[model samples]
Target: MTYQAKLIAGGKIVIPAELRKALGFQTGDSLVLEREGDSIVIKTYAQVVREVQKEFRTMVGEGYSVDQFLAERRADWGEE
Candidate 1:
């Protein structure tokens, strides 16, 4: 769905109602914006967190505790 929106004053662009509904956005929701090769990508905070977790999961794998991993690293560094 392509919707053209105008850049309003104070650099605020109003997201269309239909687009907001499709994206499951609501009032007072936080959004993250990324600049990718001349394009802007908008995502919800939860979506960004999931993406980050996915990237980290490849290194940590499933059923691995990040806290435990960090503690081991700290032990190796003689910090704990």
Candidate 2:
């Protein structure tokens, strides 16, 4: 769906209700805005995390669990 959103006087744009419902956006939902050249992208925060994790695993070749990594890092920082 396409929408022509207006930039408010304070530079805030109100998302249209129909687009929000279609995208599963809620009042408190977080969104990320990314600009690449002349184009812009918006996606929910959850989607960004999932995409980041997928890319990280591909680059790092994960074997150890997240719990183990965090524990080790905390110990290095003298954190319990």
Candidate 3:
């Protein structure tokens, strides 16, 4: 789903409603923008959260609980 938006003189572009809906972006939501060569990428806060959740889910496959993992690390470091 591609939409065209114009950048005004102040370098501000209003995101199209359809594009926002497709990206699951809501008003006042945070976004991260990055430049890749001649292209710009915009990601919403929800997108970042989804990516993190996916990574963490993979890391926890048949793994210890949060407290157990922390305790093991502390023991290894000799920090109680």
Who wins the lDDT comparison? 1
If both were scored by TM-score, which would come out higher, candidate 1 or candidate 3? 1
* Candidate 2, 7-64: lDDT as tens digits: 8998888989998898888888799999999998888999899999989888767775
RMSD of 1: 1.9
User: Each candidate's lDDT (Cα)?
Assistant: 0.92, 0.87, 0.86
Candidate achieving the largest TM-score: 1
Residue pairs in collision within model 2: none
Q: What is the TM-score of each predicted model, taking all chains together?
A: 0.82, 0.71, 0.68
Give me the runs in candidate 2 sitting further than 4 Å from their true place: 61-64, 68-80
Judge candidate 2 at residue 69 and give its lDDT.
Answer: 80
Candidate 1: TM-score? Answer: 0.82
Off by over 4 Å in 1: 70-74, 77-80
Q: Looking at model 1, which ten-residue stretch has the lowest summed lDDT?
A: 57-66
lDDT of 1 by residue, 1-80 (tens): 68988998999999999999999988888899999999999999999999999989898888789798999999999999
Candidate 3 regions with alpha-carbon error over 4 angstroms: 56-64
lDDT of 3 by residue, 2-47 (tens): 6899999889899998888887889899998879999999998788
Ranking by lDDT: 1, 2, 3
